[model samples]
Target chain A: MSDFPLLEREMNGKPLIYLDNAATTQKPLAVLQSMEQYYRTHNANVHRGVYQIAAEATDLYEAARGKAAAFLQAKGAENIVFTRGTTDGINLVAQGYLASRLQPGDRILLTVAEHHSNLVPWQRVAKQRGAVLRFLPLRPDGTLDLDVAAREITPRTKLIAVAHISNVLGTIHPIRALADLAHAAGAAVVVDAAQSVPHMPVDVQALDCDFLAFSGHKAYGPTGIGILYGKKDLLAQTEPVQYGGEMIDSVELYDSTWKPAPWKFEAGTPPIAEAVGLGAALDFLTELGMDTVHERVQDVTRYAYEKLTQLAGVTLYGPGLNQTRGGLISFNVGSVHPHDVATVLDACGVAVRAGHHCTQPLMRWLGVHATVRASFGVYNTRDDVDVLVQGIQRVQEVFLP
Target chain B: MTPNLSDLYRQVILDHSQHPRNFGSLDGAVAVALKNPACGDEVTLFLDVADGVIQRAAFEGHGCSISMASASMLTELILRRPLEEALHLNREFRRLLQTGQADDPDALGDLEVLVGVKQFPARIKCALLSWNALEQAIEGIDGTGGNPP
Candidate 1:
């Protein structure tokens, strides 16, 4: 609790009860100090200078890549590439890997539960490559319909992109099984782990996904730094989307040679300080242990589900208690708009997300304009859920009359 | 509701939200649909124009209380008014929501209740959703509606 200073602050004259973890988590002291230390003592352009500070900066940056590789349990640091965020990472794969491979009339398989970052890039690639995009529908409880997936992942499918955990519904997909299905069909799988990586244990090796992407800020690291993990062989074959400094091996007037894999992928100066902060954040999570963190958040989520279900006219979306769920719950309070509910909750110092959550297609599929989402993090407790329940009661009191 | 929230969702605003005015489509009316990309709230405004005046105005949409109520009051204020005068009120309504001050308070009528929305920087868009639709609808109007005043 003391490590996260922002949680101790006040909103609307009451202690802040932040429940917007799905958007981004508050940074810890360790991450903050690490970024500060990098700026103060190790600030230098990496990989270029002949001086000592530049070498030290290069070491720190590479060490952070090692941390990210270990965090995702990828094969090695060479398999990891630094990106702006999950969107950037997915776009990289779309253009660098799938765009050139896609053939006319080929298929790209996706789920209705994907975030826009995972969905839009594929749409762009499908359009550019003259390929068709197909969607695997969800069951009523928000889980993927495997029967549909089995039927959809035919030989013609060149790529399958999915969210490991639905951002709005919090329904955890069966990634291992999906990966096997895609592999059997000779299609590559891309996992959007933006929501799952921060909440639970994720092993790229165990999942056997061809590619995976996650943002650092969602895991309590600094923003502007993210990870794109790919199989070494696949990354070796994929082209670099961005071209310029550092990524070049040697250059002539009109033609140039390039470096290999991850180095070639990181074209510019890269997010040096942000990567240092992300390394510290992964270290913080590693020290706490991911299983323990998962258990703690699940406890809070179960308590929230129990309390939120008791309220009359409160409709919870996604999975029920018997299903596998994640660290968040999205719901609507009767006919009271989620925006109104969120605003009233803000008056009570309970901050939650209320919008399409960048999943408008899913919103349309769910027959809703938007939903109010109360997500959990490491520092949240059952007491925070109680305040949220109280704030919701206030919303009913104000709007139901 | 807190004092500040009460100011934002006063009784009149609540009434309009519960039962909006001119809330269905009008036959042969010029229509425009607008959505707040941030929140997914959408409103479709329809205008029946004749000569240079707005014969009728209505909306059909779903959104938060601020958006629904603002749409309801927008219909009531713009009915039977000239296109130019209605556009003026739309501008004034937006000014009130953004700055909490209206140059002509009487010109805004029931829309003035949304003045409290200025305090909620995040929700000003909800209050302005329907007016923005109205602006777009007026733009599509042919010469039957004269130039903006």
Candidate 2:
């Protein structure tokens, strides 16, 4: 065994219990070390330098883009544009692609289970462009009532943006089916894979979505870097929203000709170091093997749902235990506010998230203000779930018994 | 490592949570209601005050054991004390939530259980809900030396 500190140092002197990976992951030393090594060894700007340091930086930067593209099974490196994060990536598409394309009568379709980052961008674009915004309704089980989603995708639908996996519900949406239906409606598909990419196999080609976005932090990488995967031809068609340094080709005083594809989309210095960190994080995930991570999260999520449901005070939300959910579960203990539940969990050094989780619409759908969520990761063990279960049982011993 | 949450939620708290003292309203009396809307903890206090003495006090709300127990114990503590002294304890307990220690012990027994709540940070509102309502009632009745009621 490696004699290194477990990353639970933030738990404040009690037993180290971490369950907020869905919010962001605790960086393993590999990611941290890669970032540190980058800063220590070669710290220079990329793409526009003749020096050896600059050459190294540029090569690594482009290599990171290639790694990201391959991870998503995108067509080429040109299809992967580095951005601040998934929200920035989606906003870019909304502003660059849909803003100009959407007309007054056109419809933008989405699901209520979408995080605010995915929901609000389209709303702003729709309102600004006078386009009609429509939502796919949710079922009692907190899934996008897929039947309704299918029925709602009409001829007027221009672009369908849906979460690949719901952050709040932990239910994996039918991305493949949704993509097929959206394409049949003659609409483009944009997937918010922020929750999906880190946990499962995401072949954008297989899902057949035109574009996909996911954040690095949610996938155990540095916070600021994310990948926006677009089809090569579609990326060439969309205009670059952000205009600044490093995303240029021929510039005259009167008019400028911007670069094409990935470079055109990545404006300014870009999260260069963070992108390098993302590459390292990808390397770490590769070492663990994404398939193993997928299976492990599935097992853990199922175990969590089952264990929490069997407990007397707890109520499981989203899909049923051992069902087709992803790496997390959101639940509420009886009569206890999620905030209180999290607080007691914190007292026991069991850190769980307790809030709407940025899915206010989904919260309203579930008839809950918030819920105590325990998300799983590769580092998580059966012991962690047991700790959470025992903690909740202690809550019963404390308050109910 | 396992954390024993039994240390946090004592049986006294469960006793109060299950069978809250002064559980109903006083009908015609000074009432003050407050809610921690962020977390959905609500408390409505019915104080039967006459001749500047709290004759009886009761409450009803939906909340966690901490808030409910705090409400139950708060009612029991202030039942017969002079309105001004009850007001004093309310102020003192609020201070204890912030400072985690207070000078008054006789007026605060198991009430000390929630003093540890300050450590949790997010739940200070849950622990302080009833005490805040009690303070509001005292302030409303006397008006803090403003106009005659």
Candidate 3:
């Protein structure tokens, strides 16, 4: 916002407490300015434009695709496709690949801890293709039961889709191990990295997954922009789920030929401005260092987990107190409903997410309709946790009595 | 400025939420289970109807303060009102929730403890979940899925 000066406000007659990072992170000033600069000075459609502004916008847009590819450590930008978000990306692969390949009697393996976005699309496609959908069980503490996953990944399994880090549980899975196992079984794997990408460093090639999906909003960027990193051969072989302009090689009265890999998958105009914002976010993260971000989140989550349980009636879920997890904790206090917990916290000017968090199956597995989530980001401090703990205690006092 | 917590959590309101009145099943009475699935707040409102009048009303479930307190207050007023009056009360609630205009705020009395719930739009559902269930029960409908609408 260089051209447009930014503004900040206080809450509770104090500085605003923002702890809702897992839901959507607040973009840094740099990200905001990059977006403002692009819109103000170089506002134009990309790829199909011929004017000076169009070329400039195209450079920024294509540069963003290249940057996203580099961030994900993919070999080429062609393997990176722009999607609406993680949900859209996974839905693309499900419709494009599963519909064409998976058939009757084929088994599609998924973990019980997946978000509804990740779980539902595969289930819908599997049922339509007459495939049997199976779950790779979960542990009491909410981590996936790897032994159960092994047993479930049988010869009939044609595809496997699992979350890299569960949105509800916050447990980071052995994605590479799962990918190797799926490949050994002659099945492809799709990794839902929506939770992991924001909190940890990711390299899709090293992870060896067929496809990986994550959203921009969670990664300190604008919404409606996401990255889908698919292996080159697989992306080429799969059909485009969405048909529109910029995706066709040539069109005739009788028939049309589709483009290759990334562009073929990215139908319509794509999220141009939002994609630029994502690129800027990635650069900002790189400057701060993902390792440091992950470390900071881990430090804060562990602190909150230890201290939060000290309050009476406080309950915690997700990875173990010591187990490495994404930067959030989802839990409930006493018999206080999550909505009540959230409302009371809001009254104290502390924000937290309260709902199924789009992981309803995980909610059912945990035997609760919803849980309040407090997630940390690079911008968050230990003071935020103090506020959360203090606020939660207040909720218990209000509800328990 | 920090909003006063006491404004939302009055003692009388908290009392009603903690020890809700007329809270049990009246067997063979029409019931509707309405839940704000977003927050796991559930309440099953039991309607005891006789001669097209709401003879007695009761609620049995758990939720937030606004939710439980409103249900307790709802049972108290809905008991003596006729079927049409209860429907009208529902309309007034739907309106007063948006604009604190009530021709008979004293008629509502301590039930007006719910008026401040209007300030928090998200919690409005908590205050109205029971009333919605009551509406469904009177009209021969079940809010949650099981049988058809």
Candidate 4:
């Protein structure tokens, strides 16, 4: 508990019960120190200078890439491209990889449960290429309808993009099965692992996804840095979206040759300090063991779901207790807006996210405009859920009265 | 409830949220739709202007108590007032949300209760949603348009 120093703070007059883990996790002391140490000792442009500090800085940056590659069980650092975040990574794939390959009348398969980050990029590419967008529907409980997926993925389908776990519903999709389906149809698979990588073990090779993306901020590291893992062959074939310093192999008067794969994608001075912080975050989680972390969060989330269910007028979205879910729950109190609920809960020192949560289409499909989400992390405990329950009870006393 | 919470959600606020004034569409009224893209809170304001005075004002929307109650109270204060006066009140209301103090407390009337919204920064958008729509409606009329036909 002391590892995360922010938990000691107060909201209103009470101890803060931080449950907005889905939005971003609170950083630990190790990550903070790692970033500070980088600036204090080894602040230099990476892969540029021959000086000692520059060499060490470059080493730290590349080492972070190695850590990220191992974290996702990719082939090597060559398979990992450091990106701004999940949105930037997905946009890279959309513009750099898919833009040239897409032909008129080709189809891109997606699910209705995707975050806007995953949906909007593909929408623009489809529009530009005169391609059609096909959607896979969700079950009543918010799980992906595999039957519909079978019908949607045809020979015309050029790409299949889906989230490994729905950020709104916490429904873990069958990515491996979907990959097999896409492979049979000759369509590439792109998995938005932003919500999955932070909470569970994610092996891109096991999933056999062509491309995978996740953000470091959600995994208790600094913002502005993320990883986009693509198969070595696919990355080699794709062109660099942005070109400049560091990424060029040779510069000529008329034509410049660009570097291979991940370096070509990086383009400029990368996020060095943020990469160091992310590496430290991965080390911190590795020390804890991902399986242990996942178990703790799942237990806490299940306890919260149980407690929330017992309350009358509470409508929980996604699967019930028997079914597996990620470390979050979305629900709404009867006739009470999520904004009001969030405000009242804030006064009681509970922090939860409220609103569309960047999933407006999913909200519309669920016949709701918005929802309140309470998400868990490795640091959350049963006592925090108790405080959240009390806060919600206070909300009922105020709004439902 | 704490005094701050009580001050934020007074009985008057609850009443107005439950029964918003001047709700529904006004026939032959100029309409403007506004959405707080962050939260999906929406407001469609309708105004009937006759000879530089606001003859009628109504709104239709769904949001939290603060936003809905603010919309209801806005229609009550702006109806039958000159366009300039309504715009002045809107400015004063925005000032109250921006800073803790309103220029003239008495000028706000029942809307003065919303002055407590200054404490909660996030809810300030909710309280100002309809007011923003009101501004856009007037600006649309004053810039390139004339009075309601």
Candidate 5:
């Protein structure tokens, strides 16, 4: 699968071994070409122009919405609202949906392993609405403690926001079960599927989540485009947080009416080229099959996990190789700092993420300041893992010896 | 295709990182903690200044070799120097790193070894963490008139 043109290029003279897919995936030629085609042929403002080119632009943009809806297995295009990214999507729910529904004593439940994007928004909303922010604890191995989740999610919980996959730990959370429990308590379930959607099969209906959010860039699509999937009824009830030209139905000097659902949320001219790119990305994944893509990554991750564990002085985080995990592994070598480890790896043309992964609380919980994460994508191969293993050994030789 | 490791992680830098000098808190000293939030590198610098002179300097933290070695070097170089000279050296060292110059060997002494860090832009922050902490501590002293409490 080295068909990706970027993989053929050299970094620091060596072929680049990109193991930072959790940060963002490398776009395929199809995704890039589709985006280029949109700008070169159908370059026009969507939904506003009556001309032929504008009509084609509008059709392509709306068709992207349809593709996104089908990709997530949502009800229809009405359920999919475009946002900047996962952060924007969550902020929409926090401000537009939950802001009014939240009461003074209501609880917003989240797990300890959530990325800052998922955690900080709730903190702001909770503070705004006088709602209490609570956490569902994790087990020793970094998996969520469902028993604690069962007890903590009480009737007072207004919303249960959690990551479908822990970005730092790479452990997949039990979203469907959590959604069921939250639904039983009359609380809406909002999933930060930023990591999960790109790596696995995510059917909103199957998970039974009230709302789901994911980014396009992380799924081998372009930035500035993401999807927020909400139940049609819930979206209709929630107020739009933004107001401007495209979202309006009718306007007066002091009074105005609004369009319905998705359009109402997407204010101003949307990211037309970016939405087209995401549609092409989804199409590419569909052709390859998500299951095949998932299995490919899992194979690479398992190989990396096994290799890293065998090396002395390497402490691996998250679940064991035998357990279920997303396509990543966070680790540290001896007393070598993660930044230094990453630097040494970069010298050998291996790019890994070495930071808190935006999960500082989880870092504190893990008793580490930071970790070096090697995340796999569909294009990764066993040879990439071998190079990563060798690079890590070089780090050990440099720092330890 | 491997990068030249010796240029970045020199023997002296590695040795200083492994056996850091004055790696402890100074009692009754002005202290300030600095953190590189992106990488989680942290250093708490404590300076015992007496009548415009740095009587002692020490630090304690967990970070990479560049940061730890830079902190160790900072403590070693600032001891017994007047507060003004210490502050000046901090600025001079930063300028050297930013400009990638090593001309002032007589003044910079052993600190000149850090000139190699100029090539690696990302590692420059690691090499400057302790100096930042020292600058903050000095500013704290200036603001409080040496009575850090």
Candidate 6:
């Protein structure tokens, strides 16, 4: 069945082989239709509309939250709070939850390979709170050295934030084990699920993480919406960073009383349509089965990895082909710059991301300025990999010829 | 494949990128580094100016073929030209790339190869990196009375 209508389109008179899914997934028709239907039928402000349309809008928005909660296997809908994206979600936890609890001697432990979104907030929080920001070094294979992590995380570590999957390395982190380690050290664990949530099954309960953050657009949903799932007791104790209309129970001139966990976190009119579209995205993934999607992605990634390895002058990063990894590969070809590689690939109608991938620390760690990354989504096939391999060959010919 | 590849990565641009001219630091030169934060394309331009004329121009950095080649060609074109003329050349080259029209062909000789960059809006910044650095370097030097310590 033709699930992806976008794949049918052509670029430069060639079929579009979109391999930049790690940046953002192309939305399926279901997501588009869901958002369209919401705008067409239930177009109203959420939470406070006494009118029927407003109530429907509120219902759809909340229903999306519930679906997101179920998707992450959280305790209930109240555990889910909507934000702009993964960056916003992490900022909420960093500013609202961790900042108040951290002391001068406390440490915020994170991996060296975290996206700038995950790393910068903690840097700011640490600077403000006098907390020490510590990094868990990566192994030679680009996977997290959990042994080093276990050694670094101590009683003084109040919060441990790490990406569930490296956006650059494509190595899936051992979140459950890391969470267990953090909890034993009296540290609350926060999972940056922006890369993991879309490609695999991420059960919050199974992982036992205190907080998890993900963006909807990365998982085939609309932009400008994401979810932050925190534990009920933790969120209840944590104060909201943003204070405005619709989030307070009672507002006095000098003092104010706020609503419960999720609502208190959501200030102002949230992304109602985007949430509805994310709900539809969850439904689409659920029907297709996350396991099926994960397996398909693994196959495509493996194919691309193997194909890239065989090519001369190509240096691949991250885990081995046999090892479990996310559906992407970051690599460099000879001395050709990634921007030039991506431009040549674009000429051949292949879309890829070429830059630091927002992991500048990791880029420095990797000893390269930048690398070309070809990532996969569910719509990708072996044929796409074949085309990408051919495109890389073309890049080599142009640059290395 | 269509000829768009050749249109973008012309052989001359490739030659310059592969073996960039004046591709090192100059001794006792006033240097300024410019970076395209979006793509991590960085260029550190070094200029040896004496008596309002560019004595030597060189750069050292890593970027795409377009950017590296543009930097190489920029140094070659601006060398021995007066400071004002070099700044004027920077403006004319930017205009040509932005408008895709060689309004002043005599001013932009080798830089005209970058006219194809106008077709790719995203690549325009890559083409402009060196010129941007040159502009900043000239302004820095001029602001310091054409001689900076």
- Model 2, A1-401: lDDT tens digits are 12114653646557677788898876778778878887887778988889998888888888899889888888789889898889999999999888888888899998878899999999999999899888888777767666888889999999999999888888788888998899898999999999999989889999999889999998889999999999888888889988888888988888888888889987788777899889988887888888988998888777787788788767888877535888888888887767667867787678889877888788778877678889987777788899899889866655555
Q: Report the Cα lDDT for residue A77, model 5.
A: 99
Clashing pairs in 6: none
Cα-based lDDT for every prediction: 0.92, 0.82, 0.83, 0.92, 0.90, 0.92
Q: Residue B141 in candidate 3 has what lDDT?
A: 28
lDDT of 1 by residue, A138-164 (tens): 999999878789998989999999999
What DockQ does candidate 1 have relative to the true complex?
0.57
For model 3, which pairs clash? A1-A33
Q: Which has the greatest DockQ?
A: 5
* TM-score (2 decimals) of chain A in model 6: 0.99
lDDT of 1 at A342: 95
lDDT for residue A269 in candidate 4, whole number 0-100: 91
First chain TM-score in every candidate? 0.99, 0.97, 0.96, 0.99, 0.99, 0.99
Which whole-number lDDT from 0 to 100 does residue A62 have in model 1?
98
Share of reference contacts found in each model: 0.72, 0.31, 0.69, 0.66, 0.97, 0.72
DockQ of 6: 0.63
Tens-digit lDDT track of model 6 for A263-375: 99888988899999999999999999999999999999999999999999999999997679999999999999999899889989999999999999999999999999999
RMSD (Cα, Å) for all candidates, in order, is: 2.0, 4.6, 3.3, 1.4, 1.6, 1.4
Clashing pairs in 1: none
Off by over 4 Å in 3: A1-7, B24-27, B60-62, B139-149
Docking category for candidate 5?
A: medium
lDDT of 5 by residue, A159-201 (tens): 9999998898888999899988898999999999998889888
Give the per-residue lDDT digits (tens) of candidate 1, residues B53-109. Answer: 888888998999999999999998998998889889988887887778998999888
